[model samples]
Target: MSCQPQYKGQVYIWLKNKQTCLLCGETTDTPQPICTPCESELPWLGDQCGRCALPLPMADLLCGQCATRPPAYERVLAPWAYDFPIDSLITRFKHQAKWPLGRLLGQLLALSLQHHFDEGLERPDALVPVPLTTRRLRQRGFNQASLLARWLGTVLQIPCAENLLRRVQDTPAQQVLDARARRQNLRQAFAMMADAPVRNRHLALVDDVLTTGATAQALARLLLDAGAARVDVYCLARTPKPGEPA
Candidate 1:
């Protein structure tokens, strides 16, 4: 039950108060950096698979893949599809170390999550970020998932278990792999720490995006096997099926 904190500073406070739209360079009056029009025009996820959050043609329907074989996680909640501007924004934040962009996305995600919470979606007892391998951590200097989980935990008032999970193997990046290959790549990749919090409590996994969902499936399976009562996923966006329209 450890707390993950938010950044505090005059600059952070200023950003939290009011800001300009990052997408169009327009001055916005709201606390969120993105203005209303840009926010509305973002590639929002409309109908999606209830289990995996795969963009779907209709609401309240499971995608064929989920119907055939449901994932280990209970469900996924994402505000947008990983398309054009969202994809680009995430890329910049992840690769370029753009802290403000990351915080903007995190704040928007927190609002989406709060709406769900108000509508009676069960909140988890803790948030656990999908971990990065030591090699990758050294290479990147940060784990984006850990940062997202910390921001979400701070905004949502939940404890974040940052070290509860560990990546034991430095597997190939999932982005370049297809679904089946991604599953194979993640085999025996993650481990739980000695003081891991995984028993009988509802937990949520936070990450940047849900691509093939292989990483989420593996982590959720691990948590469930370790006696977690329930597990859910919260991510900024969900990538649609390959060759599908945005």
Candidate 2:
């Protein structure tokens, strides 16, 4: 179990009190909720395929690929696209060590959840974040997805389970790889822990971003194989196929 630090202070209280972009570290005298320029720059998901969450032509509700090969996870809910300031925000948060920025992203994710509920979506029984490799955890000092999951749980009134899945293998980063490569890289990388307290639960697997649905599919496969009844993905952002027509 991860040790909880003495309740020092609320994270949002700290960020909202300061006048800098929690994501990009840019200073703003009055950041518009989350830096106006930053929020505007965030890639919004519009007309995305319901199955995989990839952007689709307005005429077509389902992308051709998803229609051909549906993913294991039932559905994906992505509020934003992975581009521009959102890209910069995620890059900084994950790579440059901007940990506090996750709270800002979490707020957006919470709002998205409310919107989802309003649209008659069923809430998950538990929030389970995509597991990080132990190697990465030691290097980064935190898991952004886990932090987001905690916030998501608080907002949705669902419990967050941090250790339902374990990253058994330290796979290569997905960004530098192609679709097939990404799938292969994550194969057997994750496993449902036998000792995990989650079983037969409707789970929402949270991640910072969703690109090809590869990671989520892989993790979902493990969960189902281990007896999870259903797994849905909840991501902060989804990346459109590079250079694809909007």
Best candidate, lDDT: 1
Residue pairs clashing, model 1: none
lDDT of 2 by residue, 1-246 (tens): 769877777566665566676646687555334666666667778888878888877734888778998787888998887876677778788878776666778877788789989999988988999989888999988888888899888877899998688899998899898889999999889887778765687888999999888999898888887788889999888888876742
Name the best candidate (by TM-score): 1
What TM-score against the true fold does each predicted structure earn? 0.92, 0.84
Write down the lDDT that model 2 would get.
Answer: 0.82
Minimum summed lDDT over a 10-residue window in model 1 is located at 9-18
lDDT of 1 by residue, 1-246 (tens): 658666575444444565789989998867788999999999989988889889889899999999999999999999999998999999999989997888899999999999999999999999999899888889888989889999999999999998778999998888999999999999999988886768998999999999999999999999998989999999999998899887
RMSD of each: 6.0, 6.1
Clashes of each: 0, 1
Candidate 2 ranges beyond 4 A from true positions: 1-32, 35-41
